[model samples]
Target: MHRSTRDIRLAEALVETADTLVDGFEAVHYLPRVADHCVRLLAARAAGFMLIDEDGTVSLTASGTHREVALDLLRAQRGGGPCLDSYSSGRPVPPVSIGAARAAARWPEFTERALAHDIAGTFAVPLRRHERLLGALNVFVATLPPETASPDDAASDDGTELRLAQLIADCAALGLQNHTAYVQCRTLAGQLQQALSSRVRIEQAKGMLAERWNTPADHAFVALRQYARRHQLPLDRVAQAVIDRVADDAELRRGARGGDDGGRA
Candidate 1:
């Protein structure tokens, strides 16, 4: 397969995932989707997902989710896996072999268990958005050495696949960051609209009060606002009541006069 092309596709998929999060993406829901995409584009044989919570503990949100959820969660709890290192350090962890790792047992629990399950090597990469560490993506494979697998066979192409795996991790990070930004903007927009509407109703009430009391519009506005503040009532509700009583649209119109401070009750 075309490795570069596959990597590019993986990046695009990640960006799309990020976009969802922008509009308030859910971790439990989206992580599974990410796992699916990685399985399709990367040469990952089996994949899992994880995220770092506020308490500084990383939790597995989903596992081989597509294949072996049980083993995946076990690796995450044991906590010595490559993904943990990559996430804490904010760098990509290289693919690792079990036989070689026996010297030190990088992830004693994860290594032993995965090896028992017949996986020869594993790749763990982090998912980060901005400085926000989302979690890790873990993959298990059956072989490692190109020479040992088959000098001319497909397993020899693992180098290209490893590069693609890195790209996938990056894409996942970006997706998470993008989602956060989108949710923020949406929340801000809602607040702004509410503020604008409140302002409009308050102005309408001021005009009604001015017409009823036969005084300057600004003075009427000031009295209404002061009353609302004292009563712990919303300024808009007070304005609505004043308008209901007076119903004088002309007095409520804007551009009343210069230097008209509404606080001048």
Candidate 2:
């Protein structure tokens, strides 16, 4: 029921990093932070991330390929590795060697290719939302020399590393979620900006329509709304209709020219 001091320190560090991410840490530099944490704390030889696209496909997005560049894109079309599996399962997947996960069988080609690079083990941690799947954080370990233990009992020594890997995975998921939220906020802000710009443009064109048709501003607005409803177009598009050189449907254009006071004044 007691936690170790080392775990407490690790947890505190993760909390600090996650807090930084929540506070606008979506810069290009953050990927290296993730990589450093994995490499320094979790015995990971390599670190990578997969971003989940809107179409539900996961693509490799970042990697620590060298000591300087810090991020690289894989030169292959392959995904659905341990990272994808972890995202789908919403849990940690640690293949401490190809054998523990039989990754060579489950993901034959990727396993073979990754092993050729001395990456013989992998762990995938899911980046999840409350109810949505976001992405994955992946860690790979280089194969130890055969002379270390003949590669037969290597797993026995890997147990502690595996546990630490999972813990690191949890921290990475929290960090990733914060970054993802910041990304979504940026996307929503862009959409809102476009909408507001369109509205103002439409307002300007509506004013033009009222002047040309000699109609009151209110009447001009009515005509625009009616046209939009009749044609099943958005209001901004209708305003554009009156401005663009596209169409000049007489009745609608005339409505923009002037207003009848309707006698109730």
Candidate 3:
């Protein structure tokens, strides 16, 4: 790709990845798409993502048909590689020539697997949200012969590839945060609805008990609490049972009367 064309394509890819933030895009679905963009715009053989979970274990979250590249990324978490190092240090791992002997020595298993897939160079950047580390993005580029120089070789273009990778990583991180916030909001909404529903049920059960036993609502509540404790049941569940007529109304009446007479249920 020509330098100007490559730059334009990179900008387009960044825009495309950024657009995902506006919708309900899942991290699993979107990160791989970004990886594909990285492969196309970075001229890499394949790309993948490794996510660090709450337990601090890293797992391969997304990849393409390049099974060898995917395997190398997974093994990287265990034995250590550019992706793992980048995620840990919150720094980009610049493109490293896979043909260099030092590369093989640095990441033995990853190098062996990568070389098997004809990958020539590898680059990685941390997926970070501000100061928080999320994961790392890995791009496996085709090897270039010494005679065929890369546009990134120019002093003016130094760190350009790494910067592109970081930009994509930033977009992925934002998508992840958006997804997480959405999930948490959904969970809290569900819990609130359930709580409201349970409260309604409890109130209905109390009214039913008060009418059945000819007792005040507060006395009915005391009866319900005592019966629930005696039966080793949840108060909400006992209330539900009462509302459902699963618990005997006669028994509840007796319990309420007894509780009013100093016998707690």
Which structure among the candidates has the greatest lDDT?
A: 3
Pairs that collide in candidate 3 are none
Q: How high is the CA lDDT of each candidate model? A: 0.64, 0.61, 0.75
Question: For residues 137-219, could you state the per-residue lDDT of candidate 3 as single tens digits?
Answer: 88777755657656543223328777877888998788678767777788899999999988888888989888977788878
Q: Which regions of candidate 3 deviate over 4 angstroms?
A: 1-29, 73-78, 101-105, 144-158, 258-265
Q: Per-residue lDDT of 1-265 in model 2, one digit per residue for the tens?
A: 8875455646665765566445556535565566666665555466766667669764554545443221231322155467767877977776547554443466665566565665667777666555566676777777656675432224444556566655655666566666777788888999999899887867777687678767666777767766676678887887776778464567565444344442210
Query: CA lDDT of 147 in candidate 1?
Result: 55
Off by over 4 Å in 2: 1-16, 20-24, 63-80, 99-104, 144-169, 176-265
- The CA root-mean-square deviation of candidate 2, after full C-alpha superposition on the true structure, stands at 8.5
Candidates sorted on TM-score, descending? 3, 1, 2
Please say which candidate is ahead in TM-score: 1 or 2: 1
Query: Which stretches of candidate 1 lie above 4 Å from their native place?
Result: 1-15, 21-24, 63-79, 129-132, 143-156, 244-265
Error of 2 at 130 (Å): 2.8
